[model samples]
Target chain A: MKNVRLNALLAMGLIIVMILSLAAGKVWVSPAAWLGDDLSALIIMELRLPRTVLGAAIGAALGMAGATMQGYLRNPLADPGVFGVSASAALGAVTSLYFGYAVTAWLLPAFALAGAGIGMGLLALLAGRSGSLILFTLAGVILSSLAGSLTSLMISLAPTPFATTEIVTWLMGALTDRSWDDVQLAVPIIAAGMVFLFATGRSLDALTLGEDAARSMGVNISRLQWFAVLGVGLTVGASVAAAGIIGFVGLIVPHLVRPFAGHQPSAVLLPSALAGALLVVGADSIVRILPSVSELRLGIAMSLLGAPFFMALLFKMHRELS
Target chain B: MLLSFENLSLTLRGRKILDTISGQFQPGRVTVILGANGAGKSSLLSCLSGLREPKSGSVTLDDRALLSLNGKKRGRMIGLLPQRPDIHWNVDVRTIVGLGRLPHSGRWGMSAADHDAVARAMEATDCADLAERKAMRLSGGEQGRVLLARVLAGEPQWLLADEPLASLDPAHQFDVLERLKNYAAAGKGVIVVLHDLTQAARFADDIMVMKEGAILAAGPRNEVMTADIMAQAYGVEVQIGTSDTGEPLVVPVRRL
Candidate 1:
């Protein structure tokens, strides 16, 4: 009953924020513009609608992916970005921008999704059938470092200042000028990834007793690992592909919702996803309404918010330990 | 029905964990395995519960190969209470107990029978009152009982527990032993690994003593609980006495 109420409330919150996102941009589209075929309607449909949809989708993906990773690893600090999929996707987008392949609207996202797929493959290969958490985490760290270094190398090797600037700016991440094409590319993949994540809820719940007990309870540990990798890989990869590396949604949203959703990993998943959408859409609206010369990058905004929250979490854990 | 293992051996990182061993376990009996630290007792239990696979032997349940059974089927048949009662999440006790129903519960959710099993398990372990309490906040003894309840919630035909009484107080130890004995009396198989010989003697219908990856002695508790077997397996000189209730009381005099 509590979960139902929470889900409904979160869903309502997300809708409200999404509508505000559409209406609160630089040139506000009043109710009159929503139904009529005018310049304001054109602005709402062509620009804000797709951006709003992509923001919600990306946020949902990051949030659920974070919840799944945290649950599977049985670590509160686990996040989708920790797997290195988002970094690899960023590297792929950077590669496209560096080489000018992003001239085609679909090429960069395609490259990013491909990068995410390769990241998942490498994770699976490195972790193998051992299903050891230490091995999986180590593999993720290695992948992240490798991707980060490669992206740095690409930036350094760029022939012109323009390419470097473009790469750096995209890396900061935003929904600025994203179109319906971006929405069509990211939303379906995110939805598919969510299905894979939802499949892991029961197994993650069993894992609260630790791995051996979870396995004894009939959770095929290797299968669960595969699901987690694929789920996080696709979702985070697609989000990066659509909006660049938005950080902290996955990490912070689950922590926020866990209090209301209960401690069970399964219970936290849906609420985290909804709250994530609410958070990103709400944050995007705030950035737009804030009196800045240019809109703030969503990625930078999230990191600024997330870094402090991460520190606070560490302190809480430290207090508990001491 | 019978659960039997034949010539079972296991090697981990080039170290032999379990030597070639053969045994048959029957339902309606409480089998206690005893040994010194690093003996093969826990390893044997792991193999029995299908948590660890033996390298050179086969375990069968009612004439079918144990490993051949699907994980859910195997889980439904055998429940394991591991030595560690580590609950990674601070979930409520009922939620933790409900995890035992994972094998039996369908995709839709817990059925009425599943809920009843969880309730009954908590009742059996005397943790029903702690249902709403956070599992991580419980005392060691309370945690032990709640973990036992988690295993019992599965309602498995066979229960394999490793050091279920470790860190538990004497009262809770006796309570757990009594619960295992009562479970066996209800026609289920119960296999436990224990360090306390007196409690093992009081609770176990059959006893298996292990030494350095091999079974040193295994038989009816009266025959296997002799001073010589205890000395051989544990390297300790022991005094054996009978209690007023006619249970064997074993006390270690000194290390050999």
Candidate 2:
């Protein structure tokens, strides 16, 4: 019942934020004018709607990815950002651009997906299955640096100055100018990733007792690990391909929702995904309404919001431990 | 049903943890495995519980290969309570205990049977009152009992526990041992890895002593609890006496 209520509340909040995302942009797309054949309606249909939908999908993906990683790794600090999964995806996306293959459509995200998959595979090889927390963290840091440098190398070697600017802006993360094509590209992959993540709910709960205990409870740890890592790779890769590196949505959403949703990883997943969608759409809306001459970057806005929350969480954990 | 291992051996980090060993455990008997430190007690438990695979041997449950069974089916048949029962989160005690029913619970979560099992296990382990408390806040002994309760909730046919009484107080220790003995009495196999020989002598129907990754001696408690076997396994001279309750008592006099 509480789970249902929490899901409902998050769903409601997401709906509200999504609607506000459509209406809060530079254009005054009122509810009455939303479906008419007027230019305002066309703007809503062609522009804001796709952007809002993408925002929600990306947010949900990040949130679910974060929750799944944290639950599977049994560490609250685990996230796609920390694990270099997103960095590798960004590197892959940048490589696609550097090779001018992104103009072909579909290739960009495919490459990004491949990069993310390799990243997770390498992490598994380096860290081993059920790696200790320190070893996993160390492996993640190493991978992140490697991917970051690769991305930088690609950016530096780009033939055209236009490519550099485009890459930089994309890396800043944005929801602007996203069409139905972008939405169509990212949603199916993100949805598939979400399915894998959602399926892990009960297994993650069983895993809270540590791996051996969880295995005794019939959780196939290897399968669970593969599903979770694959799910995060797909979602984070697709999100990065579509919107660049949107930092901290995955990290923030689970932490934000965990208190109300309870600590059960399965119980916390949906609420975290919903809250993530709400957060991304809301943040996207907030940035559009800001007075800056240029719209604030979605990734930057999330960091601005998420870093403080992360600090507060750290302090809370520290106090509790002490 | 018979739980048997044949020529089981395991190596970890290039160090032999369990040498070629053969053993059989029967239901309706409390089998206590006694060993000194680094005696591969935990390794033996892990292999029995299907948490580890032997290098070149077979573990069979009632004539079927143990490793061939699916994890859930295997889980429903055999349960293991690990040492140092670590709970990653501050989950409520009921939820922690409910986790044991994962093998039984369906996609929709706990059923009536699961709930009853959880409740019954908690009551038997004397952890019913701690159901609402956060699992991480409990003392070592309380955590041990809660973990045992979690394992009991699974209603497994075979129970393997590793160092369950190391941190527990004497009262809780006896309470836990009595419960385990009762579980065996109810026709389930109970295999416990213990350091304290007196407790093993008191409660174990069968005792197997291990040293340096090999079984030194194994038999009925009376047959295996002699002073010579105890001294050889533990490397100490020990006094063997009868307790007030007519149980065997092992008191370490000095190192050999």
Global lDDT of each model? 0.89, 0.89
Tens-place lDDT digits, model 1, residues A1-322? 2499999999998998888899988877876678788888888999889999999999999999889878877778777576687888899889999899999987888788778768866876886344466788898889999999999999999989999998998899898999998899889889998999999999989989988899888999889887887787788888998899998898899999988888899999999999999999999888888889988999999999998998999899989999
| Residue A71 shift from truth in candidate 2, angstroms | 0.3
Candidate 1 on B14-75: residue-level lDDT in tens? 99999999988889999999999999888888899898989999999999998999899899
lDDT score, residue B59, model 2? 92
Regions more than 4 Å wrong, model 2? none
Using TM-score as the measure, the top candidate is: 2
> What lDDT tens digits, residue by residue, belong to model 2 across residues A221-303?
88887888788889988999889989888888888888788787888889989988998999999999998999999889988
Classify candidate 1 by CAPRI docking class. medium
